[model samples]
Target: MNNLLDSFSNFSYRNKNFIFLSFLILPLLWLGIVYLGSLLIFLGHSFFHLDGFTGQIVYEFSFKTLIELFSSPANIDILIRTVALAACVTIGSAIIGFPIAYYMAKFTSPKVKIFLFIAIMLPLWSSYLVRVYSWKLILAKEGIINWFFEKLNLEWLLDTILSTPVIGGPSLSISYIGMFLVFTYIWLPFMILPIQASLERVPNSLINASHDLGANKRQTFYKIILPLALPGIIAGSIFTFSLTLGDYIIPYIIGTSKFFIGQAVYTHQGTAGNIPLAAAFSLVPIVVMVVYIYIAKRMGAFNAL
Candidate 1:
């Protein structure tokens, strides 16, 4: 027993190459078991067909589900709309986030920096559902905006928007604005922090040199700061894009319970009870993201942003 204990004690446990590799191996194993294993299970189920007559999976491989997924016009419409919405929201967030992050990096004092950071984070801790619900009330026809208009006797403002085909619509109940607003709110922090890290890495002397060389604010921002922070921006883009693609709950609560890939997967696994088909559909977005990441990396995403 003493010999065994002595042998055990001889094993040095600091993070040497072997120790690091061992740590890495444990996580790799966990990932394989949890993620890849789940995917495989889902894929395996996809081969079995759901027999309508029997109300259970038939032990048969069929292209019926895949064909239906591809051939359906409604599914195609949803995919197109989801893609467009995600793209638009991503652009909006990038435009909005860039200015905020740039200002915070270049202008803010250290004394107020932490406070500003906390202010950005404060909403994240609040209920997502409540945020959506708040928008619901705000966007309603006779809600706060209309109430304000009535109080001011500006009745014309109400008619113009409500009468407009798609500009303002009847209410905010299930508008694209709701999705865009919430998506921007939730993902803004993601965009801010990454860009801030990149901005910090840029040597202060570089910016000072540009100023010393008589470069104006626009020239410094576009030629110096933007290029240096490209990597962070790209990283932020990936986070925002992927999160928007996979989110079901946001649309479910705020929008029209619209069926994006995440909702489709959720429905398949839970309500539709077609785990296999859901798994296959889940890969569509994963594959899309992987390609996007690869393309983004090829554009020097690693070191730029």
Candidate 2:
């Protein structure tokens, strides 16, 4: 036993590559075989068609499922809606999160920074469903929001917003507007942290140099700050965008009866028992994320991540 232990220790001491590979081998195998294998299997389903009359999946591989996915108007609408919502959520997150991130990164004292960090992350420490449900209550017609509007005599403004076409519904809790607000709130931390990280990496010397060169704040921000922060913004967008694309719960709970990609996937897979269609629908986000990542790579967003 001692000899075996000595030999093992000697082998590890002599071969760093072996030690490195020993640490990595299990995880690599798990990723390659388990995670990736499952994904490939799931995606394989997209090529198979369902026998509509018999209601069983026909395992013979073909493009019929994919064709049906794209050819259907309802399916197309769901795809478009999901993509649009993801884009809007990403943009909204960036707009709202950037200033807060900038403040945290550039202006806060260490103590204040810690406090703000805690505040930003606090929601994440709780149950996601709980936070979502809380928002549902908050956005409901009889919720505090409506009550506050009534107290302030801004009920007309509230009514005006709730009456707007496409986005409007009987109440904020059941509208796209509310869903947007919830998505932004849920994903805001993801946006803020990355931007703050990127901003933190920006040297104070650059800003000083810009000012030394007689550049105004506007010029410095536009030229120096914005460019440096672009990578972080893109990184955050990747998170917010991909998350919004895949999330079923938020849209299911908050939004109108109209379907998002995730909801479509869930409904097709379970209730409808249309696994092929569900698998095909699930691939939409994967394709979108692949494209998004490609674009982000061109813009050097991976550096920020």
Off by over 4 Å in 1: 1-6, 12-31, 52-55, 59-63, 141-143, 148-168, 302-305
Clashes of 1: 5
**Cα lDDT over the full model 1:** 0.75
- Against the reference, the lDDT scores of all candidates come to 0.75, 0.94
TM-score of each: 0.81, 0.95
Tens digits of per-residue lDDT for model 1, 183-270: 8777777777778777878888999999999999899989999898888888788878888888888778766655777788788889
Candidate 1, which ten residues in sequence have the lowest lDDT sum? 7-16
Clashes of each: 5, 0
Q: Which stretches of candidate 2 lie over 4 Å from their true place?
A: 17-22
Q: For candidate 2, write residues 1-305 as lDDT tens digits.
A: 99999999999999999999999999999999999999899889999989989999999979999999999998999999999999999999999999999999999899999999999889757788998989978998789999999999999999999999998898999899999999999998999988999999999999999999999999999999999999999999999999999999999899899999999999998989998999999999999899999999999888887
Residue 32 local lDDT, model 2: 99
Query: Highest TM-score among the candidates is held by which one?
Result: 2
